[model samples]
Target: MSDHTINLNKAHFTISAPDIRKLPNDDGIEVAFAGRSNAGKSSALNTLTRQKSLARTSKTPGRTQLINVFEVEEGMRLVDLPGYGFAKVPLEMKKKWQKALGEYLEKRESLQGLVVLMDIRHPLKDLDHQLIEWAVESELPVLALLTKADKLSQGKASAQVLDVKKKLKPLGGDIKVYGFSSLKRTGFDQATQVISQWFSQNIENTEESDEVAE
Candidate 1:
């Protein structure tokens, strides 16, 4: 079986943090999922975990309003961040969420990496760039998933993936990207591999730190 198969399926909902202060104790390694409104963020999480309802898929945008946490193991988590660019949400509430997300991205020490989703057709919009900029500033590793790849032909999907990689190359960080399709389950293994590698690297780093402290 694949490495992520067991751990991802073992994932379970932990808590929802409406604000940064409400987040769980900053002790475990976390990888967050971020995207614009209706960009298939929730679907990607569900697909990764192999749980149909784990992340709560919805037809409406901006339904995910909090930082939803899922425990994959004793000290590992998957965070579902609020989707940005929801015009229907109130300005004040949007700002509130933005503040929380920004703080979490900028200050959360346990956050090991981020998985950003974007529609294959609309690869990187303005808000997506803004988020990428934040990740660049944070010096955080990232895996960009182009969602809804089933909407396009194989050649087109491949082209889109290359296009994204070309665009993100200059950002200057450890970033791996792939085309993902929740419907066809394409790129599932690649996505899982990225997750496994990132989590394992984090564990290795922690072990090295502990050894040095001894």
Candidate 2:
């Protein structure tokens, strides 16, 4: 039961590890962001942290090949996983990135939440569905962000969000769907609130565990 607040704006770059072995000691709460190559994951991250270039946006869709870590504070981190479902990359290279992503997702003890970004116009691709399903199966909370929402009209965007929600409703897990626009800050408040709550909930859980041990 601590009163401290989580501030994503204070996030700072820590490391970009090619593999999970190179990541910091797995002792803290980490919320990971995962998406397709053209899903605007970097832009969404930059918006979340209120930094112009915090996550390194690129003209090339699959440029982010490593697992980038940022620290919001000690024991609280945000991870940017390698983009998936990019058709332009070499088959061998794509396999490697997928391997890294799978390893991180399966083995990372600190992962508390997952933020899955997909283009509003073309969401829930095969890989995206697989990732979200896996997260739900693992009982992990998820925030499904339909990125580039500004590209669509308000009515269309709202319809898209509802459609996604309806499709994922059967999973029966802790999942949320929202339309997000990094360029216009759409869903920014809801996104931040959900992510902050995840961190806070993890902190409370850790505290309870410590008390029980004592």
Candidate 3:
């Protein structure tokens, strides 16, 4: 069976602090969403899953401060990670967030793919490049979503897509991107397809026993 066919449901929540002894267990292929704060990360998540409050939307950036894990189905998890690039937070807290998030992204073995959300009007910024670099360095495939496409005119959106493409080519091959608007329910199918393909292929590759053995 494919991920598209898999029945997705809510799983659980977690808040990992610097002193926290451990993060959640990475047992299955976990697809994560990461973006800068207030970049429509939560909205896009709600849009993709057809759940209004599946992820909490915040007017302020950096509100999601946890390694929130939602089990998409029996064999996979959808991880909503804390957004990056919120510098107004305290310096000490920033350091802790960086350490915690960076460690999770780097060390999580079941993390199969990353869905990087970028605001359509403001794509390819410094923070975006940094996270893209992290995904590439980890050898993880990224599916870039240019959210809030409704804000831009069609012509402008087309141009922005090209611009993002130019920036992503250097990261690695096979990166997928789409113009999405959570409010208007646009691009849901495309994003769902991306997740479906990612999880399905990953589930096929390594067995559960093999993962445990490793």
What does the lDDT come to for candidate 3?
Answer: 0.78
TM-score preference between candidates 1 and 2, better one: 2
- Candidate 3, 68-99: lDDT as tens digits: 76777665888887787887788777777767
Give per-residue CA lDDT, model 1, range 1-214, as digits (tens).
Answer: 1233337888999899897788888996999999997899999999998999999988998999999999999889999998998799999999988888888888888998889999999988998877886788788888899999999999999999999999988887888889999999988999988887778887878887888999
Q: List the residue pairs that clash in candidate 1.
A: none
State which candidate has the highest TM-score: 2
Question: Where is the poorest 10-residue window by lDDT in model 2?
Answer: 1-10
Decreasing lDDT order of the candidates: 2, 1, 3
TM-score, prediction 3: 0.87
What's model 1's lDDT at 16?
93
Best-to-worst TM-score order: 2, 1, 3
lDDT of 1: 0.88
Q: What is the total number of backbone clashes in candidate 2?
A: 0
Give the local distance difference test score of model 2. Answer: 0.97
Each candidate's number of clashing pairs is 0, 0, 0
TM-score of each: 0.94, 0.99, 0.87
lDDT of all predictions: 0.88, 0.97, 0.78
